[model samples]
Target: MRISTITNWAYGVTVGLTLLSGGAFILSARSADHERQAVVESQALDELSERLTMAAEQTSEDARLFVMRGEDRHLQAFRGDENGERDREQALKSFKAAALLQQEMALIQEIEQDGEALDAIEERAVTAYTNGDQEGARQTLFGAEHERVQSDLLTSVRQLTDLIATRTNDALTDAKQWSDFWGAVAKSLLGLTAAVFLGVLYFVLRRRVAMPLMRMTGIVNRLARQDYAVEVLTDNRRDEIGEMNDAIQIFRDNGLERERLDAERRADQRTKDLILQMMHRLQACQRQEELAEVVSLFAPQIFPDFAGHLYVMNDSRTALSSIGSWREPRRAGPVLTSAECWALRRGRPHVSDAAAGDIPCQHLEHADEMGICVPLSAQGDTVGLLYFEGASDSQAIASARLYFELIAENIGLGVANLQLRDRLMGLAIRDGLTGLLNRRSLDDALNRIARDEQGDVIAMMVDIDHFKRFNDEFGHDAGDEVMRRVSAILSETVGEAGTVYRFGGEEFAILLEGGAEGSALDLAEKLRTLIAATPVTYHGRLLGAVTISLGAASTTADMPSADVLLRADAALLSAKAKGRNRAVADWVERSSTDRRRA
Candidate 1:
């Protein structure tokens, strides 16, 4: 029940009991009042009876005195007694008005008749004594008839007094019984009221209100400290305590919700911080491989459930090759053609799952596996592809799409930067006219070759025969065309066996690794013959028959790279002195013996 209802019930019961007790007290008071009135009336009746007996005795004595003495004082005393008899008569009349019983009234009437007879006898005696009949008066005053009448009168008064005492004592007993009964009832009611009040105080205040309030105080304190794990007790009563419990339950639920949101917020902030750190590292990456390593290191930390690969477009822009991968991703191949990826073709991210109806990327090894392909592009050019797989659930992959795109964007820019830097470096070390490694690249290559003390290194120097004459005969542009054709021949002959450099102005150099000195001289002679065989076509004009002089040097155990180049140039000068279109070697005797055997 509601607290208010309980309190009202307690109050009502207390009031009712109090009223009952009060009514009982009122009844007891009335009983005591009746008992007091009965006692007063009984006393009055006894006093009146005693006075009547005295009056009768006084009248008899006064009459005898007058008869004996005949003095006027005795006569006056007799008259005074006669006058006092009226008071006795009035007392008897008062008794008649008191609702007396029939037996008691008859007794009182008999007494009244006897007193009148006695008084008449005294009056006659008094008259005779005054009229000179002393003997007669004396006899009448002390006569047997007067004595008998007086005796009857006194006897009747005594009987009336005993009757009044008996009646009054019975009335007092009845009044006392009523007063005691009502007093017991009042006491019982008062005791019941007190017991009921104590019960209400204990049950309602102590058990219902105080105990529950104490328990709720502890719960509220824990909630204030943000301890949401604490359990809330439920109450089903429709009372104030129940209402407070419900409010606390609501507060606990809100605290749990706030805790969950706070955890998510902190996780999201940490992810953002990781992304920011990754971007900063990406900016400092000097090579595509370094950038790949950075991504590989941080990707798992960012999304541990996902396995991914970083792919960069090849120089031909036709295929993407994996530069870095993490978590041993499935279905991402080492190489994929540009046309095989939808992300690359469409320039956006493509996601595929087991339930998705869309076509999957051709680059994926498994057709049914879930995956996402995010194209990495920078400044309107697609630079690479980022492929991811192995998300535990679709929602996880969906939530991770944004981070994937962010990683792809940064990787693309980094790869693009690395590619641009490589292209610029290439231009810096390449010959503009001949499309071969320039002098600076040759020096660097020769230095590297000199450091390798275990390998046999060969250096060949070649020059066109009469190159300045051709430039003076035809135009310089035709001369330029001839030199370009000869450089192409030298490069094609060397292939992967060595590097060819344009030393300067129709002078070229070739550096080979792991070739004998005789083999080097033979290779130089073959290059001199091919330059004479092939003619140059410049703007549809054929410049005929460009021959070249060649000189070659091979490294011994301790030959420096610079000394080898100088010896090869000296041999070229010796070939020019002997004849313009022949080959010479620093070990010329070994070359001749090997040539004779061929």
Candidate 2:
């Protein structure tokens, strides 16, 4: 039951017990009053009986004295006693009225009759004595009839006194018994009320209310400290404590929810931190390989359960090829056409799983594998792809999507920047007219090749014969076309064997690593023959028979890179001095002469 109901019941019961106790006390008080009244009535009856006896005796004595002495005083005394009989009669009437029992009333009646008879005899005797018949008075006062009446009155008085005494004693005993019984009842009622009050206090206040409150206090304390693990009891009760327990349970549930949100917040912050770190490393990457390495290293830490690959579009913008991959449980091929990937075709991120009804990407090895493809784009151009796989569940994939997109965005920008830098570097080092390494790059290449001591290095210098005459005959434009065609021929003839550089307006240089003097002479002669046979066409005009003079030099153990280019230039001048459209080697002529002389 409710606590208020229990308290009200206890209060009501206590009030009822108090009222009963009060009633018992009132009854006991009434019984005590009746006992006192009984004592007073008993004393009154005894006094009346004694007064009746004295009146009878006094009349007898007074009548006898008047008869014997015959004096006036004696006569007056006799008359006084005779006249007081009326007072005695009144006392008998009072006693009869006050009597409680029939037997007591009957005794009062007998006493009244006896007193009246005695008074009649005395009165007759007193009249005779007054008329000078003393004998008659004496006989009346002391006669057998008078004496019998007086004796009867005295006996009746004695019986009445004894009966009053016995009745008063019985009344006193009964009154005492009644008072005692009610007093015991009052005491018992009071005792019973006290026991009930104590029981209510112990059971309701201490056991039911206080004990549960104490337990709830502990539970609330734990909940205050954010401990949601504590158990909440007392929910089954129908009391105030049960209501409090329910409230505590709600608090615990909220605390648990708050804890879950806090954990997610921390995890999200950690993931963001990892993403920021990965972005910093990406920005620091100097090459595509370095960027790939950074992505490979950070991707696993960012999404540990996911396996992914980084793909960069080829230079032709026709396809994408994998540059790096990490934690790939199911590997795909290294290359894929741009048309094969939905993300590339759609220019957005695409997701596929078992339940996804869309067609899978052609690059994926397993058609049923769950994955997401985030196209890496920057400035509206899709530069690469960031593909992820091995999402264990839908929740995991959903959680990873944001981070994956973040990674793709940063990596795309990074790769774009790298590609731009490479293009700028190429533009800076390449010759615009002939697409060969310019003079500045040629100097750098010569230094690098000469620094390597592995094998002989060859340098060749070629000059177009009468190149100024062609420009003077046709035009500067045609002359420019002639130079372009010659550069192309040099590049094609020296393919994979050496590097070509446009040294000046009409002069070209070649550096071949790991080549001997004899091979250099052979290569120089081939270049001379090809240039003499090939014709240049410009704007539908064919310029015929363009030839060149070539000089070749090979590195000795002690030859410096600067001397190698100087000797080749000297040999080219000698070739021009002998005749145009010819090839010469700086060391081959001396070697031929020594062999002939030996």
Q: Which candidate is the best by lDDT?
A: 1
For residues 417-502, could you state the per-residue lDDT of candidate 1 as single tens digits?
A: 88898778778898888889999998988887777664788888988988887788788988888878888999999888888999
Candidate 2: which stretches are off by over 4 Å? 1-9, 12-16, 32-107, 110-200, 223-231, 234-247, 250-254, 316-318, 329-335, 356-362, 365-369, 390-396, 430-440, 448-557, 565-598
| Cα lDDT of model 2 by residue, 1-598, tens digit | 8888898998999999889989988888888988998888877877777777776787777778878887788777766655555557767877867855778778777887887788789889988988889898888889999989988888888887888889888988898788888888889889989998998889988988888889888988988888778988646878777777788888888899899999989988988999999999999998999999999999998888888889999989999889999996474577888998889999988886656677788777777778789999999989999988887587878888988888899999999999998878878888888888988898888777667655678889999999998899889999989999999999999999999999998999999888767777888889999888887888888877799999888778666566788888888998999987998887875578789999
Q: Please state every model's RMSD to the true fold in angstroms.
A: 8.2, 7.7
Candidate 1, residue 145: the lDDT equals: 92
TM-score of each: 0.64, 0.65
Q: Give the TM-score of candidate 2.
A: 0.65
Q: Report lDDT (Cα) of residue 568, candidate 2.
A: 89
